[model samples]
Every structure is written in C-alpha cells, then in structure tokens.
Target: MPLAKDRNTLRRDGVQFSDPVAADTLIFAGALVCLDASGNAVPGATSTTLKARGVAQEQVDNTGGAAGDLSVESRRGVFQFANSTSTDQITRADIGSECYIVDDQTVAKTSATNTRSVAGVIRDVDSNGVWVEI
Candidate 1:
C-alpha cells in the first residue's frame, strides 16, 4: 500500500518531558491519565473526578503472555496524546481550541465564555480520531 507520490512523515505532537513514568496497568496510547498515590500513570476515571493529571502514550493491541505483561510495561513521560474525539464535541475542535476531559479516555470542547478549567487543547482531528495536545 504505497504510492509514489506519498512518503512517510512525522509530526510534532508535543514537547516531551525529560522523564517518563510507568502505567499502573495496560494502557493504550492517547489515553487521558492520572497519577496514582505513588505517582505512577494510571488511566483517568470519568470526567467529574478532576484528576486531570496527564495523557498516556502506550499502545498494545495484544499481549499474549502470562501474568499481564502489559502492566508496568508502557513508560511514558509528559508527551502530547492524540486519539478519537468525543462525538458531542468534535465539531468545536479547532487549532488552539480549549478542550475538557469528558470521560476516562476522551476530550471535549467547552462552551464559549464559560468558567471551567481547561484539560488540554485541540491540536488536530479528522475522520478517525482527535489529536489533543495534552
């Protein structure tokens, strides 16, 4: 599946932090995350938790080994996360647009001129998913 007119490319998604932390369990890339009491990366839990810590950047489709090898395997620092958008908020996404944590693993757009803390920002989006600068 190659076209002569097209080539591989990389995009500047985020400015990575100097250090990385391990995921508390199996986590996919682009997952909104929070810090466990031990300061490890854990999957964020629901929109109302207000535990908007950071984003995850690990992706493992299948881990067919014993004892859940995926746990503590994905180590990532403060890097920007990119993934699907909340259907209710996709339309409001634009570059530099402020976004909110709508769920454990997604982001949404905030109402204009409202008072709320911003979770991240809309870096990019398309038919597949969203690119959040978190």
Candidate 2:
C-alpha cells in the first residue's frame, strides 16, 4: 500500500468543524465549545473530562434530543472571552500560558484546582477580555 501515483487527497481548512451534540446540551452562538468524555459537543464549563475545541458558530438547541440527533458548528481560532476572577484572572504576563474554562464565556488563569478543563492558550489580555487561541 505504498506506490500510489498522485493521489487526489481531500483537504479541509481545519478551521471549522461540526460535532455531534451531547444530550440536553444547548450551545449558544459564540460560546466556547468542548468535547466531553464521550466525544460529544457541549458548552465549555469548569469540568473535567472535557477538551476545548472551538467557539460555537451558531446556537444549537438539543435540550430534548439525544446525543447525535443534532450537531453544532464551531470554528477554531483566537477569540476574546470574559476573564474569570481576581484570583483566577488572566493577565498580560500570562500571555502564551494555558487558560482554564470557567464557563462558556469565561476563562480562568488556573484550572480551578484541576476541576476545570483547559480552554486554550492565552494569546493576549486587554481591558475588555482575554484573547484565547482555541
């Protein structure tokens, strides 16, 4: 399975993806999205067994649907989100460091005692919020 003569390889931008939504999940537009332990899409939160994926592209209501019944569209990139708290705040000094998820719209400097999942790397901090590369 080696000698292939110019295979037409399929390509994707890798910036966007659609993932099956978890049961009872309602991911809002522009919310930080993550994959749960079962690889289902859910709103990012301060919980373990979650992996930050990207920002939700649009609101997807799956509150009554089971897993895989609906999917959410998300895009990976640097996005600004609300900072956490004084104790968990992300600062300019923390640039390029990993940030933790406080909720779909907030990120913290720590992992909330390792209960939170890694949201993304801190790209920049501003008066408005922290820019995270998800």
Assess each prediction's global lDDT (C-alpha) against the native.
0.49, 0.94
Candidate 2 on 1-134: residue-level lDDT in tens? 89559888899999999999999889999999999999999998889889999999999999999999999999999999999887898899999999999899999999877899899999999999999999
Question: Residue 84 lDDT in model 2?
Answer: 86
Residue 45's lDDT in candidate 1: 46
Candidate 1 global Cα RMSD: 11.9
Collision count for each candidate, in order: 2, 0
Clashing pairs in 1: 29-58, 83-130
lDDT of 2: 0.94
Q: Which candidate is the best by lDDT?
A: 2
As for model 2, its CA RMSD to the true structure in angstroms is 0.8
